[model samples]
Target: MLAVHQLYGRQSHAIDSGRAADWAATFTSDGEFRSPSYPEPSTGTAELTAFAERFHAACVESGEALHHVISTVDVAATGPDALTSTAYLQIVGTPRGESSRLLRITTIVDELVRTPGGWRIRRRVVLRDG
Candidate 1:
């Protein structure tokens, strides 16, 4: 359970710090990211890498620092090798010479699997509550 949370923490930092490869590596080989905002889910390492890389590129282009702060993490075991988690994701941004501000808040529900290396996300769905 602690390792699962750590994986989430590392993934958040990886994305915020523009380490897209590392971010994508947090997922399983065939993992996917799903959201209502996207017409299609980002599946597999290639697409996942693209997704993360694009996000980092956007932040760099805008000269702003991005952060994903995960809180209220609730984890539960679904099976011997599977676990599920629901977390509150706070997306914050800090522009040049400006204070950090909240950009958005979404609920993240992740299905994770225990792999040889560690717990990796099998699927993650981002749900926005209106």
Candidate 2:
């Protein structure tokens, strides 16, 4: 679980820095990401890569520094090699040299599996308040 949290931290940094490819690599080969920004889930590396690239391009075009602040990470060990985690997601946008604005606040539920390399997210579901 500690390693999973660390991975999340690194993935968030990668996303914030526009390292889209790197961010996408944090998931398993057959991973799935579901967020409010997109209607469908991004599954597998190719799809995830395209989604990440497009997201980074949009962020760059917007000229804002997007940051995902994850907190309150609660982990549950489901089995020997599987776990579930839920965390608070705060997506902030800060224009160059300006104050940050809260773009979205949601909760992320992640189903994770342990792999030979490390822990990887199998599916991530993002939910926001109604």
Candidate 3:
């Protein structure tokens, strides 16, 4: 539980600060991440890190202000060193010269494992909420 919370907190902070490398480090070497906007899932830590960098670059180029909120995490231990969890996410982004726009209200389902480096996400599936 504590591990899960810490991982979530760290990832959130990384995103808030536009620390792409830090955010990507929260995933395992063979991890997978998927989002509605991504045509295909990203696999492996290297690819994931690159994906994060590209995402941050795009946001910066757009001159948008972005914020993310994560809440209501429900974790279930799958093993002594693994767990599956789901949480709600809300994000808002404002374009360079426009008012804030709600980017998404969704749910994130993740499978995580406790590694030598602490808790790391093995798989993450994001589902948008209408």
Candidate number of the best lDDT: 1
lDDT score of residue 95 within candidate 2: 88
Rank order (by TM-score, best first)? 1, 2, 3
Question: lDDT per prediction?
Answer: 0.92, 0.89, 0.87
Q: For candidate 3, what is the TM-score?
A: 0.91
Task: Point out where model 3 deviates above 4 Å.
Answer: 96-99
Residue-level lDDT of model 1, residues 1-130, one tens digit each, is 8887798889999998888889999999999999876788999989999999998999989999989999889999999999999999998999989999998899999999999988999999999988
> Which numbered prediction scores highest in TM-score against the true structure?
1
Models, CA RMSD each: 1.0, 1.1, 1.6
Deviation of model 3 at 67, angstroms: 1.6
- lDDT (Cα, 0-100) at 80 in candidate 3: 93
Q: How far does residue 14 in candidate 1 sit from its true spot (Å)?
A: 0.7
Question: Where in model 1 is the C-alpha error above 4 Å?
Answer: none
Task: Give candidate 2's error at residue 63 in angstroms.
Answer: 0.7
Candidate 2 residue-wise lDDT, 40-102, digit = tens: 999998898888888888888988878899999999999999999999989999988889899
Where's the lowest-lDDT run of ten residues in candidate 1?
35-44
Q: Summing lDDT over every window of 10 consecutive residues in candidate 3, give the lowest-scoring window.
A: 12-21
